[model samples]
Structure formats: structure tokens, C-alpha cells
Target: MRPLIAIPARFSARTSALRYAAEVNARSLIEAVWRAGGEPVGIHPADTGTAARLARFDGVLLPGGGDLAPPATAPPTPTTPSTTSTPSRTPSTSTSPGTPWSRACPCSRSAAASRP
Candidate 1:
């Protein structure tokens, strides 16, 4: 069986085709995974049960999107203009897996630590 790679779809306030808010994934990412002989699955980020949810997948791929809200303890920085009107499209700092949010999701570390 092909490896099932779990990719978290980004939450968006609006999308062209959808009347309600939507979850979006990158077409290039999905196609690349398929070309590499793996199946890519997009998942919604839940408030709870993250571990139980991730345990079923063979791997994880984190795609970059969304605003970068700095930690409360960090020194303040000047505000920058948002790129788009949508709340989800605000100018983001680096969205690499090393950001503060990763600490909340253990799977980030687990996926980075595991062997292929």
C-alpha cells in the first residue's frame, strides 16, 4: 500500500467557490506526493485529539499559510499591512515547523524525529 501522508489543510475565512469558510490545500503539494508514490490526505486542524488523529497516518507535511501571531512574551514588533482582505491572508512571518505553534502539536516533533 502507498504511504498515507497527512497534510493539514489551511483554514480560510472565504474562498471563491464556497459560500461558507473553507479548508484549502496546495495542488502542487498533493501532486508531488502522488508522483513520489505516496497518497496525500488533507485534514482539518482540530482543537483536540490531535495525537489520536495523527497516529493513523504514515507521515505528515505541514504547508505554510495564516498569520504569525507572536508569543505574548516576545518583544513587540511594528505592524505590517495585510496582503489580502481575508483574515486568513494576513502577512505571515516564517511558517516553518519551528514556530511557537509547533510546541502545541507534538506531531510536528514526532514527524521530524521519525525515520522514513
Candidate 2:
């Protein structure tokens, strides 16, 4: 069986076909996972039962969108580059051990290849 990947959907104010608000996962992102032989599951972005749900999946693909809410105590920072001169890199935010988000695989250049 292919690995089941959990991709949390983001809220869209509207979708072309839907009359009301909608939850959406990126089509291209879903296609990429499918092409790579993984099952992409679109899940509601809820705060409860996260760890249990994540434990059921083989891998996770954090979708391209806004950053996850910063740790409550810290001030907000721009995730984007301030100037073109500076090199671009995604900053890592540390989380506590045994948390669901911490279970996500680190995507280093060497680890770009997704696995089940």
C-alpha cells in the first residue's frame, strides 16, 4: 500500500463552484504526492486529535500558505526575506517533544526524496 500523507486544508473565502466558504488543499500539491505514489488525504485543520490522526499517516506535507501560528509567547516575524541580497531559507520553529507537529519529517536537500 502507498503511504497515507496528511495534508491539512486551508480555508478559502470562496471557491469557484461553492456558494459558501470552503476548505481547500492545493491541486498541484496533491498531484505531486499522487505522482510520487502516496495517498494524499485532505483533512480538516482542527486543533483536537491531531497527534492521533498524524500517527496514522506515514508522512506529512506542510502545504504552502501562511505560517503556522507562532508559539504564543513569541513576537511575529516576517517569514519572507527582507532584502534580495540576503539568501532565502525557511526558519525552523522549535516545538516540544511528543507533539504532533514535531513528528513531521525535516526536508533537508538530502531528504527531499519522500518515503513511506
The best candidate in terms of lDDT: 2
How do the predictions measure up, each by TM-score?
Answer: 0.54, 0.61
| Residue pairs clashing, model 1 | none
Which 10 consecutive positions of candidate 1 have the poorest summed lDDT?
A: 84-93
Any runs in candidate 1 off by more than 4 Å, and if so which? 66-116
Off by over 4 Å in 2: 68-116
lDDT per residue as tens, model 2, 1-115: 8777788999999999889999999897787777677788898999888888887776667764456443332344575333322312332543456555554433322234553
Which candidate leads the pack in TM-score?
Answer: 2
RMSD of each: 10.5, 7.7
- Each model's lDDT: 0.58, 0.64
Count clashing residue pairs in model 2. Answer: 0
- Clashing residue pairs in all predictions, respectively, total 0, 0
Q: For model 1, how does the per-residue alpha-carbon lDDT over 40-111 read when each residue is reduced to its tens digit?
A: 899997758776787777666667544544332234336543332212211232233533222222233333
Worst 10 residues of 2 by lDDT: 82-91
Q: Cα deviation in Å at residue 17, candidate 1?
A: 2.2
